[model samples]
Target: MDALTALHNRVSTGKLTEPAPTEQQRKNIFLAALRAADHACLRPWRFLLVEGEGRERLGGIFLKAAEQAEGAALTEAQRQRTKAMPLRAPLIIVAITRLQEHPKVPHLEQHMSTAGAVQAMLTAAYAEGIGAYWRTGPLAGNPLVAEGLGLANNERIAGFIYCGTPDKAPRQAPDLAVDEFFSYWGAH
Candidate 1:
């Protein structure tokens, strides 16, 4: 698919199955992310690819974090759900933002750069016929999760991108009116 087409039509695929993206597809996706706009060239981002057994390990970490946060209040179903979260997709990419004290660029801009990279990867994945979903919840911000993922004190989780083969056809992108979101800012 063309770049513009992918950018306009990309949609998150929540139901993913086995057969993760091929090596070529992953190369394309990562390359797209590398081209994201960066302020002051402060490349403050890193990614961890987890698949197969690694997903199971991530699920364990998630379960631990959830259990810690909820204590005895969490039911068995909730615990099971937390442990199975990583099994939703065949491959997972954990996006991390490494904040630094830059004279010009602040931490927020660094995060924005990471967000741009993730969006680019999503579009590239769509073009490559790979299912992708960006997910983040309370667990993403949990200190236990951060520590389990071996994140540095200056690094934070941006999101977890699940990628694999779509269990079904991707849903159509919503038709949003540009006029409703954009307007010319000129002398009126």
Candidate 2:
């Protein structure tokens, strides 16, 4: 698919299955992320690719972090569900913003750059026929989850991007009015 098509129609695929993106597809997606607009060229971003057994380990981390946050033991069903979260996709990319001290670019801009990078990757995945979803919730910012993932003090989780085959065909993109979202500056 063309870049414009992907940008306009890409939608998140939550029900991903096995057969993760091939190495070539991953290369393409990762390369696209590198092209994200960065202020001052700070490049204050990094990513952790988790797959295979590593995903199960990440599930363990999630289970621990969730329990820690809740301050109580999770029920058996909750424990199983929590540990299975990472198994939802065959590959998971943990986007991290490595804050940098810069006079021109603020930390928030750095985070925004990481977000743009994730969006780029999502677009690339759509172009390659790979299903993708960007997820972030309480576990994303959980201290134990960060520590388990080996993040540094200067690093913060931007999102967790899940990539794999779509369980079903791609759904049609919703048609929304652009006027509702777009506006001209100081226009009537």
Candidate 3:
């Protein structure tokens, strides 16, 4: 698929199955992420790829973080669900942003760069016919999660991007009117 087609029609797929992206597909995806626009070329982003037994370890970390945050014990079902979260997709890319002190660039800009990287990865996946979804919730902000991921004090989780084969063909992209979200500024 062409770049424009991927950008215009990319949609998140929640139901991903086995048969994770091939090595070539992953190369395309990661290279696209590296091309994300950045100011001052801080390159504030990093990614953690988890799969197979690694995903199980990540799930364990998630379960620990959730339990710690909840204080009260989680029901068995909830515990199981939390532990299985990472298994939803065959691969999980944990996006992280490492904030750096810059005279002209602020921390927010660094985070934006990471977000752009993630968006590029999503688009690249779409172009490759690979299913992908970016997810973040309370778990993202949990301290235990940060520590478990071995993130430094200055590094923060941007999102967990799950990539795999779609269970079914991708659905149609919604046709949203541009006027609804765009407007003329200082009209001629």
Q: Which has the greatest lDDT? A: 3
Off by over 4 Å in 2: none
- Estimate, for each residue in 1-188, the C-alpha lDDT of model 1 and write its tens digit: 99889989999999999899999999999999988889888888999999999999999999999988988578989989999999999999999999999999999999999999999999999999999999999988999999999999999999999999999999999999999999989887
lDDT of 2 by residue, 1-188 (tens): 88789989999999999899999999999999999999998898899999999999999999999898878678989999999999999999999999999999999999999999999999999999999999999999998999999999999999999999999988989999999999988957
Against the reference, the lDDT scores of all candidates come to 0.94, 0.95, 0.96
Q: Is 1 or 3 the stronger prediction by lDDT?
A: 3
**TM-score per candidate, chains pooled:** 0.98, 0.97, 0.98
Candidate 1 vs 2: which has more TM-score: 1
**What are the clash counts of all predictions, listed in order?**
0, 0, 0
Tell me the tens digit of each residue's lDDT in model 3 across 14-118: 999999999999999999999988899999999999999999999999999999888848999999999999999999999999999999889999999999999
Candidate 3: deviation at residue 100, Å? 0.3
